[model samples]
Target: MDLDRALSISAAGMAAQSTRLRVVAENLANRDSTGQTPGADPYRRRTVTFTNNMDRALGAPTLRASRIGTEPGAFPERYEPQHPAADERGYVKTPNVNSLMEVMDMREAQRSYGANLSVIETTRGMLMRTIEALRG
Candidate 1:
């Protein structure tokens, strides 16, 4: 593939990974969030889904964020009778976000983004070298 196409592909990958990282960060940030009112649901963990779309201009498939949806998992129940949001059963609904899982997902997304950035940098260097060689 040409250097321009390579850069474009990597850029798309970086964008997708950036979005993933953002979602992961949001999940981590809201991990401890609880409902304000009694018997109300707490913050739900968000998830990102990616898709490969054909870029007509580049004539290549690029990764895109297909959807940002809530996790379909049940929230954990914490027995905190003193809490303001406790239900009649003296249970508070905790967010489904697990800090460990969010941390791992964030790390994975960061590595993927770094890899894509490296690809762009390498392609740029190669293109510059080609130009220099032609001038020489």
Candidate 2:
């Protein structure tokens, strides 16, 4: 039924968004993570890419978490000679992650996930009503 297909699509979307949220959370958690050794690179921000692929069983395009890759940017440097991760020049490399950007991405993912949840709920309700009508 069309309602079944709707549920499938929404479920896929929710799954994708959940993955995105997880990535965002990881970035936020490691925003301050630095390298253990001096002159080593710090933790880089991770990015999630979403793609739509054909679901042979469902015969529909579904959202998928295509890749979780590192963000390409220069890591910010802070002058902290006492830090273990400090370079020879007495500057420590900070993670490339921006807390504000991560938070914004998190908010967007949460909203997308919520919308998918709502669709699933509505589809289930419609299915239940249809079955009830059939019994009557």
Candidate 3:
């Protein structure tokens, strides 16, 4: 692939990973969030989904976020009777976000972002060397 095309592909990948990281951060930040009113649902964990699309301009497949969906897992119930959000059964709905899972997802996103950055850097270096060789 051409240098510009390579850079475009890497940029697309970085953008996708950035979006994933943002969702994961939000989930972690709201892990303890509870509803303000009684019998209300707490924050549901958000998930990032990606899809591959053909980039006609670059003549390559690029990754894009298809949608930000909610996690299907059930929310946890905490026994906080005094809490205003508690239901009649004295249980409050807790966010589905799990600290460990969020941390792992964040790490994965970081690594993917880093990989895309490295690809861009390498492609730039190669292009510079090729131009220098042509000058000589």
Candidate 4:
């Protein structure tokens, strides 16, 4: 019920979403990265996992990025015989990062961040109104 509590919660949410956004950006940037050696693994897409932890200072549960982990799966291979990273079978392992999926994840993170920001703004407005009422 406290405005400060609301602000703290929203701030934690924003921080979590910010980490998600950063992970998405990193995945997109390294989407095309390939290993220099033949049969080597290419870049793996990184994922953000959030956890709800009790904030002793705020006395409320807040969200945080628990870990940044890589997505585990076989990389898609392309027939590129001449490529340095190509295997003996003439197949090159491509990054597991999917552009469309990353874009969707980015959009979701943006929406969450915007929602938290909106809450913070609303809390600020309510606090200002309360101050004015007391002054009157």
Candidate 5:
């Protein structure tokens, strides 16, 4: 495969991973967020979805973030009678965001992003060498 095509594919992957990281960060930031009023819903965790498509311009497969959606898991309830957002039964709906899970996801996204960046750097180096050889 051509170096240019490899660079394009890697760039697309890096972009997708960047979006995933952003989504993970948002989830972590809102993990403890609760509803403003009693019986109101709190912040829902957002999930990032990706899809691969053929980039006609690049003539290669590229990845992109398809959509950002909410998780289907039910919100856990915490008993907090004194809290203003608590229900009549002294139970308050808490966001389903888990700190550990978010951390793991963030790590994975970071690793993937780094891998794509490495690929881009390697490809650029090879291209530069090829140009230097041709000139020499």
Candidate 6:
């Protein structure tokens, strides 16, 4: 049925967004993480990529988490001479993650997941109603 296809599509979307949420959470948790050794690189922000793939059974394109990769960029430096990760010049390389950006990404992922869940619930409700009417 078309409703079954709807459920499948929405479920795929929810799964993809779930991965995004996890990545965002990890980035936020490591916002202040730094390398232990002098002049070593710190944590890099993670990025999630979404892709649409053909689902043969559903005969439709479904969303998926395509890749989870690190964001390539220079780490921000902080003047912390006492920190173990500090370089010879007294500059510590902090993680590339931004707390505010991670929070925003998290919010977007949550909203996307919630929207997919709502679609599944609505489709299920409609299917149930159809079955109930048929038995009448």
- TM-scores for every predicted model: 0.97, 0.97, 0.96, 0.96, 0.96, 0.98
Superposed model 1: Cα runs more than 4 Å off: none
**Please, what is the whole-model Cα lDDT of each candidate in the order they appear?**
0.92, 0.94, 0.94, 0.96, 0.92, 0.94
How does residue 26 of candidate 1 score in lDDT?
91
- Give lDDT: candidate 2, residue 19: 94
Off by over 4 Å in 3: none
- Model 2, residue 60: distance off in Å is 1.3
Candidates 4 and 6 compared by TM-score, better number: 6
The segments of candidate 4 whose C-alpha lies over 4 angstroms from its true place after superposition are: none
Q: Looking at candidate 4, what is the lDDT of residue 38?
A: 98
lDDT of 5 by residue, 35-80 (tens): 9889778889999999988999988889999999999878999999
Q: Number of the top candidate by lDDT?
A: 4
Model 3 over residues 1-136: C-alpha lDDT tens digits? 5889999999999999999999998998899999999988899999999999899999999999889999887778999899999999999999998899999999999999999999999999999999999999
Clashes found in each candidate (C-alpha, N, C closer than 3 A): 0, 0, 0, 0, 0, 0
Q: Write the per-residue lDDT of candidate 2 for residues 17-133, one digit (tens) a residue.
A: 999999999999998899999988988999999999999889899999999999997889999999999988999999999999999999999999999999999999999999999
Model 6, runs deviating above 4 Å: none
lDDT of 5 at 28: 92
TM-score of structure candidate 6: 0.98
Lowest summed lDDT window (length 10), candidate 3: 71-80
Q: Per-residue lDDT for 1-136 in model 4, tens only?
A: 6789999999999999999999999999999998899999999999999999999988999999999999999999999999999999999999999999999999999999999999999999999999999999
Residue-level lDDT for 94 in candidate 3: 96
Query: Could you tell which candidate, 1 or 4, scores higher by lDDT?
Result: 4
